[model samples]
Target: MDVAEENSEEALLIKQHRKEKKEVQAKIQCMKNSVPKNDKKRRKQMTEDIAKLEAEVEARHKEKLEALAQKPTEPTQVSSITNGVTSLDLGSEEPVQQPRVSKAQKRREKKAAQEKERDDRIAEAEIANLSGARHLESQKLAQILAERELQIRQIPSDGHCMYRAIEHQLNEQGNSLTVANLRSQTADYMQKRAEDFLPFLTNSSTGDMYTQEEFQKYCTDIVNTPAWGGQLEIYATCVWTGGALQFCGTTGHKYREQLVLPDINCHLEDGDL
Candidate 1:
């Protein structure tokens, strides 16, 4: 076969491999979803099967690519007569079509982009918050706390600090809940009452309302991942339990005011230290 024919064959082979891979992936997803959450033995077997199938698919794809690469390359010329004139087309080739992105892949890419943009905003906000005035503000905050006879209770600086702090307060109030329990409960509440929380939540990067899928994903991450707690989570916690979260810190020139959750009322003084 000529070089053009070889290219066409190679593209066709790649397309076939892609189709096979996609079908296998779909089957794997179905298998995962079909299994009961508590069936450890069956889940393990399904996992093994999935891994085997994925390996087989990858091997087949590799073999096809290798076979295409090993094909002999040659160029041929064909003659055509038009209007009593002979013309030779030498090694002419068609452009190889690229694989189309699936909708799921597109969604994944969009979510990743949104996350990156949100991280960038958080970094910028952090940098902006670190100012020379912070020291003075902290001293003023310390004086206020001393006046109120309240001492700062330092929680561990781990990512779960927010949850830990909440748990500590709960324990003091005779409501003992672990951090994991708190996280799961908060995530569940936010998901079930998404409408109540979704209106107040906006995309930090886009300044637009969150789509249902995005909100669901956010809730899922909170439940399944070590996602850092923020305003929405604090609000969810307050709503889940008829309690309030008092936030105190420095904003700009003044000591950042206290924020009461659920009601979202801001008080200048008398915040939880």
Candidate 2:
């Protein structure tokens, strides 16, 4: 006699009625298709059959309500009154009814839910990747553009004036700006960039970021990069975050993927050019 349970059963009754209505409609359609429209007597007979079916459906629904209302809800009390015993009719056998939402339906629903979840995850990952890549690439491009603009402005204006710079230390017996000095400075800058971007590259929050014991070997290998052939030297820079990787130029807008080593471990092991 649980009111909540009764309400749930009522909902199931409504669902069942809807299904029955569809079946009735389909049968009516089939009957109509099987008969000739020109036959008035046959049409009248079909209408009577339909009317009887509707009446039967309504009567059954009313009977169902009455049965539910008269249901022996207090099971334990009833069982006690009957001494928990029933006379067995051993010769009689009742057919078992199949369950609602069959095994096939359950399997299909489970598969559909899994597929939906997988698709949602894929969509989220794709959006994150695209956003990260776009932001990094745009930021790098903006900075490069700004620097080029500044250089252009300088060329037309005070081209002769040496830009403001802090002279940290003086090199002994050195030219103002020798090729060796520039290379050394560029190399240091490249190394620092690699070290700083290590955590972002590796998608990690802890650790020393890099380990370099063979300093000489590392330096030698880096200097021998394809970009270093015949003093036709080139400089490269790559920055990678957890979601995306981007490579910007040192001299121009050129991008070289081979020189642009991605991932934190690669940065630690490979010598940057």
TM-score leader: 1
lDDT of 2 by residue, 161-197 (tens): 1110101111222326433443444345455564543
Q: Candidates' TM-scores?
A: 0.45, 0.24
Backbone clashes counted, model 1: 0
Query: Which residue pairs of candidate 1 clash?
Result: none
Model 1, range 1-273, lDDT digits (tens) per residue?
Answer: 466654565545654655565566567767875565455667899999988987776666666565555566333211111110111111122223345658797677566655655666766765775674755676677777788797567664445778998999999999989899999999998887777667766799999989999898888888777688987688778767778778776665566555555553432232231
Each prediction's RMSD over C-alphas, in Å, is: 15.4, 24.0
Clashes of 2: 0
Q: lDDT (0-100) at residue 102 of candidate 2? A: 66
lDDT of each: 0.66, 0.43
Model 2 is weakest, by summed lDDT over 10 consecutive residues, at 160-169
Q: What is the lDDT of residue 241 in candidate 1?
A: 74
What shift in Å separates residue 40 of candidate 1 from its native position after superposition? Answer: 38
The lDDT, on a scale of 0 to 1, for candidate 2 is 0.43
